[model samples]
Target: MKYTFSILAVILSSTKILIAQTDSLPSNSIVLQPVEIKQYFNKQSILELTNSAHTLSSSTINSQSPTSLTSALNTVAGIRMEERSPGSYRLSMRGSLIRSPFGIRNTKVYIDEIPFTDAGGNTYLNLLDPQSLESIQILKGPDGSLFGANSGGVIRISPQGFDSANDEISLQVLGGSFGLFQQNLGINKKVNDRYQFAFNQSYLNSDGYRENAAFERKSFQTAHQFNYNPKGQLKLFAFYTDLGYQTPGGLTLAQYEENPKSARPAAGPNPSAVEQKAAIYNKTFFSGLGHDYQISSKLSHYIGVFGSYTDFENPFITNYEFRTEKNLGLRTFLSYQNNDLSLPFQFQFGMEGIKGWNKINNYDNNKGVMGNPQANDLLANQQMNLFSRTQLDITKNWVLEGSLGLNKNSIRYETLYPLESQSEGNIKFDNVWMPRLATSYQINNLMALRASISKGYSTPTLAEVRSSDNTINTDLLAEDGINYEIGYKLQGRNKNWLVDLAVYQFEMENGIVRRLNESGVEYYSNAGEMNQKGVELSYWSSWNINTKFLNSIQFNAAITYNHYRFGQYSNANNDFSNNKITSVPDWTMSNSLYLILAKQFQLNITHNHTSSIPLDDANTVFAPKYDLIQARLNWSNSIEKLRTKYTLFVGIDNLLNQKYSLGNDINAFGGRFFNAASLRNAYAGAIISL
Candidate 1:
């Protein structure tokens, strides 16, 4: 395997030199660089965008493998991972409010220009194979002129693909604290100058830190690219993922204080009181094709088309009630670039459509007594959106970008029980439009200033608008919002240091809030206007020193401050003037440091802190602030003769074993608390590349 890779590498290098010589331009003349075929693992250009964006390189991602993507991203500043169970994770930025625990994340997640989040705009990070990823780009703010829908922001993941000149294979096995285990294999091959293929597969399992918090997942990804000529390129890629997990139901404050390790049993005398022994299963598959065409020396065009489907099921502790959801979607985009314009300009347009079906069923003998209480109501929905954006270089050092989008949603509810009202069984939401604009000015070679203002909206979901019981009205309007932001970026000292600062304010009209009706069944309703304002700061620096034993030291830190309030509320039954919004923290911060030592070794340390937050609208329960720390050591070596390399890494998370709750929420069984802001965890892993 190693010899083959070496041979392929040699051939590719030689071919590249020959092509360069053949395409060489005249001496003293400016020459245009030839375009190379796109690869899944290529580094994304973070600095090319005028919007605030951050890129996590492959070097950093590789060091944190065999860990959840959520865990890895939590290290970033202004980013938070809110998780209720192994299968459910939410990525929040700048103190954004999280609406759900499952698949349709309010924040958009993407992979190589493809949307990974479901139709509802939610994403499941656990399902993604971290080993196959090359880099992660996080775009903050509503500058969706290039990307479409749910563009409050975007989390873009890039994968590793075949190198036309190289044949390579790699393997990895990892084990850690809490009975955790993982294995992965990858291969890349160049069939010829015109074709290349890559394959990757991985499996992971873990018995979580908290009792009954266990999970297992498997994933497969493949890519193939065809180069027809120098001016045109086409690539096809597909991915499939399977996930299963059990959740340790969050404990009440009393239960946590009594015995943090004691978990509710899966099967007990009272199913409602026991920990949830749930079976969660999901399968996602998607394929995409893209083409790039150079129309002329001054003009270029590109187009992409994709189709995808997702199916998921969750069975609760009662083993009688279960929920299943299926999604199918199609997306297409076209873009044109022109360098001949007065200033460089790009225009893009796209269309997206999705259909979703969801059902709740009863399998046990228990009737309305337990499980499938809402079995009578099933939902089918469809949504369509059209979007467009334009970007122009307004001046030598200033750029302007703008985007517009329109969306329409329709839903149909089927009722099995006659007692359920027809009004709650059929619903249609109004179409909404969003527009955003942003501008950036380069103050100098090392500093830039940026500002953006955008409008965003969240439509009501079937479950949010309709209920099994007819007590609540489903005619409430959709939630609408507007966001404004201003920020700056600085890179100094030969690019060894980088800093990003941003402040934002958001206002929501008719925001959706879950309310308990007279009969005690919780239902969703439009709440009064609300506002959230926050600031974020991130900094990173690397110092190289010539010393006897030390090579370099790197430090990074991120901090956020949020203020939330109700802008308007009028309830005839009660005075809610002093009510506090639920689940939002006032302050959050994270920091990390790395030291390069002698030999092939390195050390890392990290810390995170979050302020107290409310549990419910009434503000009766409060979760206090907490701190967590982690440490890691890594070593690597290469075998030149065999053209292979190996790396070994050991890590300890929550070195202090701090007992803290990162998130909590009201639940059907009881108000639940999420545990382990930092878990005392250890892991060791090795990667072998041939």
Candidate 2:
């Protein structure tokens, strides 16, 4: 494997050198701008404190009209978006799989320091409107010590704010293939020299290309800021999101072979019922307050308090059995920061708390199965965390940083039939501490090298720790792991070319696995040890050429190769080794090219490829590899008198309409179901700005 990577690197390097020779231009050409690691308050507050942080600015976020946040983020390196339905998606980073679509995600997600995950830890990316975002920062690895338990990684999404210098209004309307339509409106006003406010609203609907897949959503946001004085400022913000959607269950291998686009499931001796009816309703409210004070020229203080409340209900059926889950959660964060030191040091200390409650009810046909006059089952959990980090400048060209955090969690479970005399339903977890360290050295103006090592821990969610029944045991253990990474970033002197490369290995102990007993009840267990190693490479280039009226061209490509294997697995009767991990692909790659034409017109083409992955531990079933391509065109102009601008955009996904599968269901009635990727889809839209 090492040799293979080395050879590929040589080939890529050679290709770049050749391209550079052919594209050479005089030194008088467009001068390259120098890149700086700025300490903008918001950006510095997180980047300087974390070992692995990547930021996406608003300009990059709006470069494409993505239907969901996941779609927009998919453009980044080392990030993959997995879709379960039209509006349901999961994000995987650094080879960590987000196991459940409706439960807690392995990766943590936050919007302005407020937890976005529900009671069970599941996050729905579709709830966020990409149009209202100003920036997104992804903090990778086990820095959860500062955030809380389940630190696998953190995704921080920041929304657009008010501007005191302008009064602005904007509107957008869109219509596309598959009965898709979207509308958005926003306004920003500066009431006076000291006060400003911004408000936005959006609605989206789609009759998906696949059967039984459709969705509708609405969102609203408001923000206010006050500049009390040069040394003091205050800001307040709130947002509400509501979503409704239908779940289109997976298809079987035989069904996929017969007709890829068909939504019907295969028949059985007992004829498993096709679950065509599934519904989800969710509502979320979020608010926060922030204040900043400049104690002196070299010293400053900043504080923020934020909270969110979310409620969700999902109902679905399989094999005539109906199941419903109701979840609610509350989360809050309080943080303080100080940046004052001779060596340019910044420190942040914060605490976070979360409370969640989940109830699951089951029914056979119309009859209550167990646990109640209500079939009520409840699980409650509380988590608290404290973390701090600081960076020290060791020299003009080198920097060192370290971080520490602590987490405590408690859980309790209850059932309506207390008389059943079940074992202890309450579990208290001990506080866990995590730490990280890293260093970066600048080799020159255009190159840098960095290395990082961190310890991370992930606590089991309430659903994983205390489910409704023993059929699916919830007593799974938490995961503890260590990550080691080293990487380099390089850019050409002209700033028209760039390359980033990284390699990492992670070792996890006491990983959780699910097993079925003789009673046909699925139980959780601390199965075995595992290791994951991968390499990622990315390249980007932009250049201007005088050919066929084309002003410039931009291109980007990235690929990640992962290898994972289990070290041990022991069942009651036997032990196994060298089992390949499930649902993790060995190879994934994506590339895009953009052509900038005259008159604010442009065209973009993109392609993605993923290798086959084992669906089960036995490696008997596999999801085949496939390739996809998409194209887009955009044009913009202004209404001169009104000082307003308009943009018209169109896109075609899966231009070839190739039949492929993007994900599969491992927990179908018989564990034999899959979801086929979309085919030949199109979108068109218009944006009006003032």
Candidate 3:
């Protein structure tokens, strides 16, 4: 990793040569444009943001493999996205994966303005094709003041051009190593000045690098917007996904080093992944409708209604589980602004509510066959958040803001299986208020300083409350914490270079952590106290060179340092006070370079490094450090007579074939810890524009 940093330093040092060469360039040289970041409650320029946020454009996403967002997102500091296997993803923000072993928890996800995360705190982020999104905005650290009940931060995913009125069609096909195949289709049409439609469809399948790790997904999405009134629009959208993946299970250190591509075999008392046909299957459909209206020049209202249904099944080494889940929700908000006064002010108030119903059944897995039932349970969950934000522009360059949210969550569960296991029933958490105060001062057009203090909380997700162990954890508590942060941003003279730096500390109580059982099943328990301190820094620059064959270049580098430790924790056999927090790396860095030559060819390169990670609270074992490199190349041409444009692209992952695990099982029982990642993989694809 030190060597990689040195390479980056060399690249940075060469900037002077490039700058000197470009000083007398022709007039056609490219000039980077200022960026706008919309992650805030109110739209603002990236330099004006008061919190830590990163934006990834569609071009950046496409620079990676056409299948997943893992590589593109990894380039962002403070965010971690893991794929234990294809189509199976787990996400974390600022070391929040401590409680999430398989799915997305503690975080809040939004597709456009719709709440995509269910009331139970689970997000099916893998359901969407990465290319379908126009951009992804991530707000790091806890931001419950406006998003509500999230300790890991917020992810705002914006789909392609909902407001654009262009009639276009495109198709893409891709094939890669390890029996990979994919197809994507995109369509957009402007029926008239008042009506517009956009649609996306994608399919992907892969026989993964390891045995019993095959995966497949079919996704479809559509959006419609109608301008019934001059000042308002009616919008409708739907998303459907049929996704399935095989779980290869975990391996021991010896097995990982010897045969990394092998599946988990039979242990002393457990069946093998292959023998049990370990896999997961899910089919979900979600839809929503909304109306946005401007009642007056100073006030506006927006409302949306949404519903979803999911059919999920999982076959594991120990059991076969089936679940049926449904969600219904509503969201409404109003905004008012007064810019005529000497000091301009704006405010937005909104409320979101959702109800979730789940029915789960678990049966014995007798060698790929489901036997007698073990547990049958029914559960219902409800969550509501009333939030508001007000911002004042005291002097144009100085901004002050205050935000608050009132959150309520409750859950009820009933067990209907083996009558002997009559656990608890209803559980309700008291209403909590989260408030934040922030200010940002623009010292000049090229520099800015910001600070904020906020309160955040996360309730136990449904999976955490009733884990695969078939036992209800009635004593589980919500984790609550306060975060204090200060940040700085600077841009170079020509706006070609931009830098962002943030430092923060968070102290939390009753932190949730994952626990594994003898059969590899998982549960959750509350760790007493934790202190998390971290620094995040990023630099980006883009400029066009003067050479005839060389066109433009973009470079970005980011790093995060975490000093997370347990403040108070103890169990029956150990007291881990002052120990390193589990599943967090002390240092992580990412760098990306994009180059365009002759205006017809392009190349993108990305590199990422992760330091050693503590695997448990005791800090006795660790996952060694590792690095990854991905590169892509593209060539484009146009047909003058056919009015068409096409691109040919090829990319490779894990260029060095480094041996490491993209995801790991923490505190795993029986020394079953490693989940091997793919090595030396390559992909190629073609895109046609019509």
Best by lDDT: 3
Worst 10 contiguous positions by lDDT, candidate 2: 365-374
Evaluated against the true structure, the overall lDDT of model 1 is: 0.63
RMSD of every candidate to native, in Å, equals 9.4, 4.8, 2.3
Two-way TM-score contest, 1 vs 3, winner: 3
Residue 7 of model 1, lDDT score: 31
Scored by TM-score, the top model is: 3
Question: Using lDDT as the measure, what is the rank order of every candidate, best first?
Answer: 3, 2, 1
The TM-scores, one per candidate, come to 0.85, 0.86, 0.96
lDDT of 2 by residue, 187-280 (tens): 8788888888878899999887667678888999888888899888787778889987766666778777776655545344322222425556
The runs of at least 3 residues in candidate 1 whose Cα sits more than 4 Å from the true structure, single-residue gaps closed, are 1-48, 95-98, 143-151, 162-167, 190-194, 265-276, 297-302, 317-324, 359-378, 416-426, 461-473, 514-523, 569-580, 667-669, 674-678
List, residue by residue over 461-490, the lDDT tens digit for candidate 1: 554554323333457676667888888877
Q: Over 4 Å off in model 2, which ranges?
A: 1-52, 101-104, 118-120, 162-167, 190-195, 264-276, 298-302, 318-344, 359-374, 417-425, 466-474, 514-524, 546-548, 571-576, 667-669
For candidate 2, what is the lDDT? 0.64
Per-residue accuracy of model 3 over 591-634 as CA lDDT, tens digit each: 88888778688888899988988877688878899889999989
